[model samples]
Target chain A: MRDRVELLRDMVLVRQFEERCARLYQEAKIRGFVHLYVGEEAVAAAVMGVLQPRDRAVATYRDHGHALLKGVSPEAVMAEMYGRVDGCSGGRGGSMHLFDVAHGLYGGHGIVGGGLPIAVGLALADKLQARDRVTVCFFGEGAVAEGEFHECLNLAALWSLPVVFCCENNLYAMGTALERSEADTDLSVRAATYGLAAWSVDGMDVDAVTHTAQRAVEMARGGAPCFVECRTYRFRAHSMYDPELYRDRAEVERWRERDPIDLHRTRLEASGDLEPGAFDAMRAGVDAAIDRAVAFAESSGLEPLDQLTRHVYAAGPEAGR
Target chain B: MSRVTCRDAMGRAIRRALLEDDRVFLMGEDVGRYGGCFGVSKGLYDEFGPERIRDTPLSESAFVGAGIGAAIAGMRPIVEIMTCNFSLLALDQILNNAATLRHMSGGQIGVPLVIRMTTGGGRQLAAQHSHSLEGWYAHIPGLTVLTPATVEDFAGMLGPALADPDPVLIFEHGGLYNVDAELPDEDPAVDINKAAVRRAGQDISLLTYGGSLPKCMAAADELAASGIEAEVIDLRVLRPLDDEAIVTTVSRTHRAVVVDEGWRSGGIGAEISARIMEQAFWELDAPVARVATAEVPLPYPKHLEDAALPSVPAIVGAAKELLGRG
Candidate 1:
């Protein structure tokens, strides 16, 4: 793994990028459903750090961070949100469906718990083909309430599939709290019943996520489907339209005290991996990249109306690449 | 020509696919050791082994979605839902993931998934196990729905459907599985896009597919006996309707009786009738008639179930009523 300095930069890149997305959403520059990954940067950054470029990752709708971690360029990512023809998904997917197969980001699935079965299938293929790669499926604790979650977990275990189920327990599934949504909030315990080697990690700490993910990836490669429930929280509302009525403001503030980016930055500084004032300079570079992404997204063209019916069904052998 | 059951023909088709493509595998409930719920995959598990002829748990959504996932990830997975009724559990995955992924990804991904399900009711399996919903699937744009009635279609359609880059749904009507038919001299390869004219006549067109094909043919025979000379057209493909065939047949006959085992309202019959109105209204001599299952949850009792479904007499009666000879 690269030094913590690089990890902090990726986290800051996500933080700075989505912070701009929040502002851009307000300006009417980017419309439609926008779910931000404000506080959960460490999970994507650390988990992706453990994966090779050849490996696949399936993520949920709040997936800008995951897309970036999987190496989708900031320009393509922002253009997708802009609904432009040049976006990673040609602006067809928008924020909820950011798919860049070249980057091995299988999808930006919009449905809750919808991507689990697909994830199991991806891993199943790799195993059947004897390909030495792991597929990481990222979903929230809320998805655990879905039957697909249980079904997929059981199926994956039965097959000994090469998949790592990373549950980012953001404590909420939209407006419902984890407690209200599930019988037992301990997602790891529930996963254990399915014969998977499951555990939870402190998602606020990038190192903890990295350590847990490295082991999980190893376990997956060894033909054991594992589950890692990262105890994290989204510092923002579920989406831009959310009224934020379900949770207490004090609770948000309390969780904010251990901000993932801030915690990682402090750790890097204490370990002498960073010089004083390094975060500011690093963030400036990331912000400049985000600015370029915004400019590119703004200049890109919208898909023509006549082409609206395109790709509904493939006409050729090389249909969907 | 050799005689073969629809079930064996379908099994041969699946077996051929597995032999031809290493990427092709069949996965579904009771498909492995159980030899498929309908026995359409009998002896496949032993021939292809467990890896290729995978048997999955009863979780419809997961297995179906997994098929989509595997298809997109470079495996040609043929997933079988025990029945169309059970497929409702996996509708979210099918509608949201399998059907929408290619377009949603801007054509960057296509789910080359082939989903097979048994449809229609005859054996008193009751409401849950026996109701034809292929019409409902036909409404989805990104999907290709096929209702293979003849043994030839049952054997032929799978190869072409497996070749399709997008998702394809094949609804094997439950009652037709054991029908015995003579195999042609050559391979049974046929088109998946056009309708097949089963019997040619000039009085009226009897349009149908899947299990309803035989019923329509029987009705056409009855009409022929009564000097009606009705033309029977098997609509093999459902989603991309054979509009040309539908219109041309109606133009030739100037009247049509659409037979569907599904419920009448908002069914495939409705869609076909609307298309006929749009394309062949001028040629039509009388209003198009639809013979569909009674709009009720199929009953368990044999008598009630028989009453609920479209029968030969009902189809014949509809044909006569349209021709003003009832």
Candidate 2:
């Protein structure tokens, strides 16, 4: 059995880190579309728990939680939010484009549905090179409407590529609800139409997400692409700029009642997985980590303007000549 | 040396690349079983098998983006779009991902992908299938745009483009696919960076590329008959244009006429004209002139299509006008 306490700890860490980010945004410390994963922590924590170090991942813009869970340092992620040189993307890509190639996190793609084809190609490379690795591409419900979604799914299934398409259906694609965008609201069914094994899981429950993702990862490792729709909800507005005009206050309140962290903590406590003061100690540790991240972000230096165009092309024999 | 068509030369290039590198593969619509829409990959499928000579569905965005992904993941994938007209479907992947990935990822990844597409118009394919759009791709900063106008270039450009660290787009003129040219036994190593001086003259410079090169060469012969020596420069590389070559030729001749198959306004000819004005203003004996396609959708009729495209007469007229000898 997997450690329920560790899962709970990760979710709590994400929650605390995002809450701190919200306060920082309010103070004008972090700029440019800061998308918080306040309530969608369980999906990232659980899904990432099943991925090995060798496996690759491609995440969307609201990727702080995914990056952190995938082994990108909290300090680097926050520094990226601060647009500091020490950030994972060296301050070139801000919050919406966190990238850590060393950790196998491909990128935080800004465009919707942009990562799907890249994921397929990555899987194709592994299959061609005879490497036993899986590439997990995480996109939102909004990405399903893109032509690339259908095209990539067909290609992946046709090639039997080692790819696990993780759709974190947090209901909103920017302010538009999934039901409003998609005529057929069932995402897993749409993925199944591509002829790959597809299913959905309870995104709020860590155990459910982990169990479902583990099976999908196994299927991908066996050279069959699989799709999983994580039915989750984002508690906060889509971004710092969103006034949330599309969502109702009552709906947000109702979804908050199923807050992933609270449910996981309650489950752990009921199963005797937590000691009397364990939750408090874990919270304290998470708070300290967030504080350290904030300090690192604040103290980090900005990138020099002269080096602005350094990475436009890789350093090569004829590059920049 | 042996004579070969541009089609056979390109097929030879793909075969050579596949044989030389275990990581290289070809993927595109109708590239495998159907032998490519233009028959550029006629026997590659049978030779390399389905895994390497992959025939993809008509999903340009996915396959092109997949090529970029495979390139980043340590595989050299040469993706072909049937024609430049259909390449608009995958422009998002080419512009947003392949061109931006290395810089956006803080240089952690490089897309060593090569995309080849048939461009220009000569067949009665009409508007949708006929139009030169290489100038559009040339506008993007991170992309390397190449227009191979010779048989050696058509056969040799692919190797260096695949070896490059960034994305390279090769635009093969549709009309030149069947043109015959002699290839040396040991094909001279072609550089995608330099513009080739196809013919040398001293009276005026005729600058052109791709489908316009032959017309410009013919115009030079006609000009020579009129005692006007026209220097012919084939602009093999479009992006990071050989500005030095352009300026040097114009400096010697002191006059220039740019010929392009694309529309005059905002076309590559316009860019070359502006570069001449910027860098060779003092060297020019007369104003730089341009011969380009008439700004209309290419027609289906042969006579009207020929009239609309940049012709030898148009290049000769433009050169005479630039030299004030009309």
Candidate 3:
């Protein structure tokens, strides 16, 4: 019970930080396509509950929340979003690519469905090297239809690689809804056909997601792969460019009424687990962290223009020959 | 040392790579149980098992990306795209992820991977399977493209390519796979970084690579008979071109002809000509000439395909024009 409240505080911090990012994106402080995991906060918060620091986690472009929940500093992520050299990937990755090798956050890939196979290979290496570490890969329901998604799941199952394939079903891929896009709306069933044990959890409930992910991770570490489909919603547009022409206003309002952060906070307050003072402190902490991150990013130097062509090839001095 | 064919040389290279390093493995459609579509990986499946000599589904993009991921994670992966033409399916992986990972990661990761694809025409495999796309990849900045045209290169270049930390594309000629020649008693391993002069002359220079090398050499032979001494330069490494050798040869010969199996406009031949002009424009006695494939899909019929691609006669004709013989 105590652990749940602590994790709830972490989730609150991530949610508050992302809400600030949305404001920043609108204010023109952050550029490029910004995809915030606002309604999907519980997905990261829950997954992080089961993931150890030694285990790996790779997510998609909507990954700021995941980075924070996975133990990466909100400041580093926000700094990366600001494109500063002091950030996690030296600001080269920007918002779409948030990689923290120190925290086992392999990357925040920009390409759609690009990180699934990479996560499979990471698990293969860990298993081959005889490590007990498991790699948890997070992608949206849109990725489930990709050929790479199928191939990666098949390989993971066949090799019995230690990997947990987490699908955050946000109901829409950019503008296309799950009903309009996937032939099989039941993503977990689709994953089950690949010989993997699949689970579908209510992504709005952080406890449900946390419990489901814990089992999946345990199963992966037990010499097999597992899949978890977290049924969630994106409260905002897919990116800044999206005009939100797909869904009805009523649908948005309905999902917004069940916002994951508010739901968790309500549950905590009703159960007498969290006080108003604690919530105020958590909000202040998140605000201060975002402020510091923005300052750090502004202070960090930009990479020199002359070094743009550097790291194109791994060959150092001899490669020039 | 045991005598080996080009096919066996590639096999031996893969074998040596696998045995020497636990990280090395082979992956491609039909590369495992079917023995590589061209028998290049025969007997490897039984020896290395399904784990190493992996037979992948027809999903080129996924497997190729997986190969990149594996390489990034410290494994030396050799991804075999049955033909360079099929590499188009995996273009996103090759061009987007594999090529840009090093720069995008801010030098944190390097793709220590090799993508070996058979290239060039002459097998009557039609348009979809018969084209050479090495020139397309060469235009990219990060990758090192190698065209090993001889039995020696087929036997030798793999070690150095695998030893290098960066990505290397080995374009094995589709025709040269069977063209056997007497190899040296010792491993006459050559440098994969420069152009090798196959024949020396003082009149004109013929620059070519891959399947076009034999035709250029034949043109050089024919030119010799016609009292036109033509130096033949085989460009083994295409991307990081041997500009020094090319400039010196063009300066001395005062004439040059580039023979490529690809199309003429915006082809590797054009790039080479542009580079020559950039470096040694004044030294040339005449403008550089080029013999390339006719702009059309390569047909399956023997004669039409032969007529479409650059031939020995075309090479000779271009060489003669450069030498003011035409």
Query: Can you give the DockQ of every candidate in the order shown?
Result: 0.60, 0.73, 0.53
Q: Write the per-residue lDDT of candidate 1 for residues A203-264, one digit (tens) a residue.
A: 99999999999999999999999999999999999999999999999999999999999998
**Angstrom error at residue B106, model 3:** 1.5
Q: Compose the digit string of candidate 3's lDDT tens values, residues B240-320.
A: 888889998999998999988988889999999999999999999999999899998889999999999999888888888
Worst 10 residues of 3 chain B by lDDT: B181-190
Considering DockQ, which of the candidate structures 1 and 3 is the better prediction for this target? 1
Reference-based lDDT, each prediction: 0.92, 0.91, 0.85
For model 2, residues B95-197, the per-residue Cα lDDT tens digits are 9999898888778889999999999987889999999999999888678899999899998999889888899999999989999899976545888889999
Give the runs in model 3 whose Cα sits over 4 Å from its true position: A316-321, B184-188
After superposing candidate 2 on the true structure, give the runs of residues whose Cα lies further than 4 Å from its correct spot.
Answer: A316-321
Q: Which residue pairs collide in model 1, if any? A: none
Between prediction 1 and prediction 3, the one with superior TM-score is 1
Minimum summed lDDT over a 10-residue window in model 2 chain A is located at: A312-321
The positional error of residue B18 in candidate 1, measured at the CA in angstroms, is 1.1
* Reference-based TM-score of each model: 0.98, 0.98, 0.96
Clashing pairs in model 3, backbone N/Cα/C closer than 3 A: none
Ranking by lDDT: 1, 2, 3
C-alpha positional error of residue B19 in candidate 1 after TM-score superposition, expressed in Å: 1.1
Candidate 2, number of clashes? 0
